[model samples]
Target: MENSHASPGLLKQANSSALHRALREKGAATRAQLAAATGVSVTTVRALLEEMLRDGEVERTGLGASSGGRRAAQYSLRRDKYYGAAVCITDGQAHGLLVDVHGEIVRAVPLKAGADGLRTPVLAFLDGLFAQRDIRSIGLGLPGVVREGCFWHADKEGGLHSVAVEPALSRRYGVPVVLENDVNAAAIGFARCYETEFPGEDPAETNMAYLHFDRGCVSAGFVAGGRVIRGCGHFAGELGLVPTADGRLLDECLNDPQDGREYTARVLEAAVWVCGILNPRYIALGGPALRRECIGPVNDGLSALLPGPMCPELLYTADIWGDYQIGMAWLTAEKIFHMVQIIKK
Candidate 1:
């Protein structure tokens, strides 16, 4: 999995990013642990740790438990060393958050969509957030297909199509900007939230799919080995255009409760298709219509549609909006620490 577009210099920074991510994931680790976790030499890990300590990126947390001989010095990320901003653009509103290096949201606010479009309000919100802290990067989660910083096919009224999102923001802020599809961003956030809530579980090792049904449109985000699959054209999860039974579009059935059985059945069919294609360990559903009451029926319907061997656990994410925010924060942090450059299409 090599990024052909990444420069050698950026790739070098990726090593430090790898070590940083390992430290973040483990919370605290010895040099040996970090080397093993990141597959880097211990000497290199020590050098990087030294640099990080000097730069305030990481600190010596404490001493590890004795392992028969010497107790190694434990290192952890300096969560307050830097901050990042995230903006999630939806149909009716744009939401923003100020996040720390530890992936914690320090502040959050909502900007309602207006005639001027999302760019103005989002930029204003980020400008205010950046004024208060040392923001290294910004991540924007647009409700559309984002390819190389350009946003397209956004919500009908969102007025975000073929817009140069990354360049505009990056130029304005003089920092790297990352643009991601909203659902995919939510999936990344969802996976991180799950990992934090269940530290014992390694979400990075499992295949997961996040299915979000919003306002009659169904989109999906697939994660395997902790990376989102954006596909060749960055359009991996555009399921709304998929046709349902009775020859109607999938979105057409979203509003009709009378068509609940067929609608859910179609959704299950899609889930089964995803299971066969991706063999995911779990499938998480979100959106206002996919309420708590619908979980049981959806599960039962999925069980009926899928064979025992093909069944994947069905779960619901109530706060996908929050997940999107967290995903943007994580992406922003990655851009800052990893020196991820914005690719032009």
Candidate 2:
């Protein structure tokens, strides 16, 4: 199926991408180390490193420890070569961070939103960052249903209802813009952190559901096969809309629990739905209402409803804001790298 004429170019691009990714993971490495990691010949690795250095995409850090003879030159992705701006709109505030190609935060810009909506604060924050750094792409995380990079639906209290955030941002910044649901972003962030903590496990085995209960409402985000499982129409994690047994919405029962027992029952119902369908490896429970005492009962209730193998480990995730920002940074960096690969093509 391979075309002999085009194979060489495609192979070169693939090898180049592998080298860059290895550097991103290793921070800096010599030609021989890169070749060994990427399974590319030493001569080909040297040529690609020279090309990247000439293009200013990579830089020489210094000489590495000599293995047998002379010290090999070390190479790394240029820290200032590309930047991605990740912004999260929540609680009448816009939090933004300037992330580099290595997924490190270059700068953080947090601002209070105005009455006009998140648009004002988001624009002002981005304008300030763009004035100083050349941002390659933008990632926006919103608490709502996002369909094809558009904010389709949110509670009327949220000012960003029915707004097309992605294209509007792309037009203003003249770069790729990604819009993702807040919970979904948090799920990806949780998965990444989990993998980092337990590096021995295969990342592809990361399947999880992150549930957030706040202000009398609950929603969920799912990650399967190391990717966010945004189903058709992008309404996959809208758990609050799911109905309950007594002919009322799930949020209705959650909004008005009589006692701690009833509250635990309501949460158990939600977990049952998540386990019965997704059967993820973990169900990360978080938000304001999630208490340490309630997790035990929720887990016990889930086990009673499903078989041992079907039940997922329930984890309490604090610091939703932190997870959201990390997720946005990861996504923005991925977009920038994808753009670089497209340019090569």
Candidate 3:
């Protein structure tokens, strides 16, 4: 009898998980829409939605356009019910933002110097933000590599090398913490921004790459089939390490921009190599050195390097910083949702 009951319970949990994920990906949906999206019966979807409504996890947000007789009710995750904290650590400063479940920033604190210095201010900011609300998870975007939520290295001295960042923060805050490379976070954020900006275009089904050129050095982050490719050791996109024909590193040539044509040539050379390798749907140019003036030359160089049919669209991401923070927030929200699923199981 207990085993018989357990089978149904497990089925219900699976259906619930499917429904929750559908709602999350779609942002908001009607009961019928959720049913179709999840491939679950309307009856089951309604039951799960009711449970979510009662738990304050879901809320009705007006009505959808009438498909036939009457307008259907729309449901959305309760944006204010939960929040996440996002921190981006750079060479000298850490930037933090408080984001709601809907991936909107509620508050942003001033930048602080050093990881240790960032701890006090960021924690205090989160403490104040969580004073009246619940923060589900925290995500940190470091300037260097991360593995299994552990800090590896950063560009600057006195970085995350010696600290057990994720565990320490998770223990301190009593919530899950995710650590990722800053460029990777920016790539995730860029994907989110693309989805938001172009609702009709699905980034999940596409291949995209974000190339970050910072202080003459370059690194790349790739997204294939909606997932970030971190590679075996989480060092997938270390493009800067690739040397040039002259036996000099890519960064060496990029740093010495005395000759405009030479600078353009080097940039184009790297871009061409990336295109040949990934053949991505699009490549976004980011980081400090990708200025407005450089775009024209880069485009010209690209035009000369590859034929029109083989060339991928090149775009300059102007909001890498903002996107990095938002990506961290989205990652934190995903962690929270996964935790909820685990608890239910």
**What's the lDDT for candidate 1?**
0.80
The CA lDDT at 23 in model 1 is 72
lDDT of 3: 0.79
lDDT of each: 0.80, 0.82, 0.79
**Alpha-carbon shift of residue 98 in model 2 (angstroms):** 1.2
Residue 322 error, candidate 3, Å: 1.5
Q: Model 1 RMSD to the real structure?
A: 4.1
lDDT of 2 by residue, 40-141 (tens): 799999999899999999999999997789898899999898899999866566788899987766777777767887777778888988898878888888
lDDT-superior candidate, 1 or 2: 2
TM per model?
Answer: 0.86, 0.86, 0.88
Ranking by TM-score: 3, 1, 2
What are the runs in model 2 whose C-alpha is more than 4 Å off?
A: 1-15, 29-41, 61-74, 154-161, 339-345
> Once all C-alphas are superposed, what RMSD does model 2 give against the true structure?
4.0
Best by TM-score: 3
- Model 1, span 14-48: residue lDDT tens: 66878877875678999999989877789888888
Error of 2 at 76 (Å): 2.7
Deviation in Å, model 1, residue 77 alpha carbon? 1.6
